[model samples]
Structures are given as structure tokens and as C-alpha cells.
Target: MKDTGLVAMTEFLRHPSMVGSAFPATARMVRHMLAPIDWDNVRTAVEYGPGSGRFTFAMLARMRPDARLLAIETGAEFVEKLRASSDDPRLIVAHGSAEDVGRHLTENSLGYADVILSGLPFSTLKQEDAETIMRVTGSALAPSGIFAAYQMRTAVLSLINRQFVDVRQGYEWWNIPPCHLYWASKLRGEGSYEDQIGGSASA
Candidate 1:
């Protein structure tokens, strides 16, 4: 079996749009991105663009036995790799776009996730697509749930701020090329998904 790093690099070279990053996140980066999560209370977690399952493995190690994880990936190869990497019944690897995270959650019979972690390169994505993902992520999170991601650029910071009520930033220089980690939390009174969509449509 190829190592996770090789697999991730190959996938990125094959599909930059889907893979997002040329290198898998280092252990340090993963730690920083997951630092704010209270695993004991995190019943549901959704990971977007889980390239090589680096963070996924870490999350599973700390999550409660009853907790469930939905790993959503656009790359077929990555999805297959993820499925093969873990046999934990608590994990559900979905092959799809992150923009439709709400549908993925509903299909899995899951309510809003307690935490949403993303490895998708929002800076590399189109502005509209990035905004759509941020909106869907905000609406799909449970009240006060966290949405965390490590990005290579600051372009998506504004989008996150627009959708989430509170936003915090951190840096990890140990990773290759380094990155900025964004920790954003949904507001407690954001209302239901329908309400959010209706408000957006009206605006």
C-alpha cells in the first residue's frame, strides 16, 4: 500500500480542484485544527475533502464510541482510500461535493453536525462555490457547533465571517508551506435551515 503522503500527492496531481492541497496536513496542523473541539461532547462530525484521512484518524481516536463521523470527499480515489483505511462502523464515507453537506447529513439520517472540519482549499475554489459551501456548512451545524479548517490563503476568511457568528484564526508553521487555521462557530439563535435559506433569499 502506498503511504498516505504519496497517495495524497498523486491525487492532488490528478485532480487539483478536488484534492485541494499537494501535501497531506502534518500532525501539527491537524492538532491545531482539532484543538478547539470538545470530543467528549461531539456526537456528530462531518469532514470535507478528507484527502488521506490524517485528521479523520485523529478525530476517531478521540471521539466517543457512540459518536459518528461522515467523511465527504469529491475524489473517487480518496473516497476509496478512506473506506479501505477504516472499518469503524461509526464512520460513513460519502462521495460527493461539500456544497451539498445538508443533503448528505439528511441522507445519513443525521441531524445538524456538532462539528464540521474541512480540508477543502476554499481559496482555490470559485468565489460562488466557496460562498455556497460556507452557507451550507453554517446551516448544517447544530447551534453553537464549530466549523474549523486550515487554509493556505485568506480569501475565504471573509466568507466564513459572513456565515458564522464568531470567527478565530490560528497559524501552523510546521506544515509544508504552512497555513492559517480558521475556527468559526454557528450562533445559538440562527434558527432552522429553512429560516436561514429564507432569509438569504430575501436578502
Candidate 2:
């Protein structure tokens, strides 16, 4: 990814209809948002709403060479921009809504992924839409998979708590309005899941 890619991303982000029109996530913030991911274990990954490839490019740098990145975006313009910015064989940009995640993977015969990363504006989505997207994302993740997302101030804390055994918050104050990175893992082995939730497995 080049510096100009970020410039174009920032311009698109500033557009009025963009969910993150108020401000784009800075490089520092993107790195912090994705820091908890274990690149070594994530072979097949999906990015929901990759907007300008901020997180997309970061994931590319960290994932294995053979790893595949399926980026789902609804903006036709951003999709073109993402495709033009790079020539990585592992990357595929899908111009569509996050809700199409399951259908896209199914059509490609790509089963549960190792990791699912999202930059979607859940705070702006209707409650039913948000729930559907989360359910689809959860279903698409491997049993031991990790699902990560970022948001500016969300009641999602409660929603995540209900579905995920463990949820950790990573904060980034450098970005305008600042933001919080939420990382949650699908339940794994009995002990591992227990460890993640501090041994409280009531859920």
C-alpha cells in the first residue's frame, strides 16, 4: 500500500454519505485496532467494510503470503479504489453490504474463516440489521476463530458479551473522536474458553 492510497481513502471517508465521514482512522489507530490479531494462525480472513483499505492493508502486511483476504464493501467507488491500489493475488474486493458475507463465502465454497475483521458502522445500523450481520459473522468464524471490530461509543459491549465468551477492549485515543477496538473469540476448547472468560462459563 502506498501513501497515496491513504490519501484517496481519506478523501472518500470525508465524503458526506460515508459512515466515517467525520474522520478517517489514522495509521496509528488502525495499527492499534489490529494489534491483537495473531497473524500466524489466521490463514483465511475477511474484512467487512474495508473503507479505503486502512485495515485491509494492515492485514495484508501481517497475514501469511498464502492467506486470502476477502474485503466486503458496499461503496462501488471504494471497491474500485481498493482494487487499483494493490496487486496482491491474495486480495479480493467484494462490492456489497456486510450482510452478504455468508452468501459470498458460500458461493466461493469458502467455509468458516480463521479470522473475521469488521469496520462496519454498527452504531448506525438498525437493531435487526446489526444483529443479522453479527450472527452471520459469528457463524462464518471457525470454532477457535477471532472476530474483531472497532467503534466510537457503542452499546455493543452488551451484545458482544452475550454471544462471545470473552470480550476485551483496546482503546485508541489518537484518532479523531478516538475509538475502541473490541476483540472477541469464538468458544474454543473448554479450558481455553474458560481462561478467556476468567473461568465464568455461565454463558
Which number leads on TM-score? 1
Per-residue lDDT of candidate 1, residues 19-39 (tens digit)? 768788877777666766678
Provide the RMSD of all predictions against the true structure, rounded to 1 decimal. Answer: 7.9, 5.5
Q: What tens-digit string does per-residue lDDT give for candidate 2 at 79-140? A: 88789988998898888777888888777666778888877767777788888888888888
Candidate 1: residue 188 Cα off by (Å): 8.1
Clashing pairs in 1: none
TM-score of 1: 0.89
Per-model TM against the reference = 0.89, 0.83
Consecutive 10-residue window with the lowest summed lDDT within model 1: 194-203
Highest lDDT model number: 1
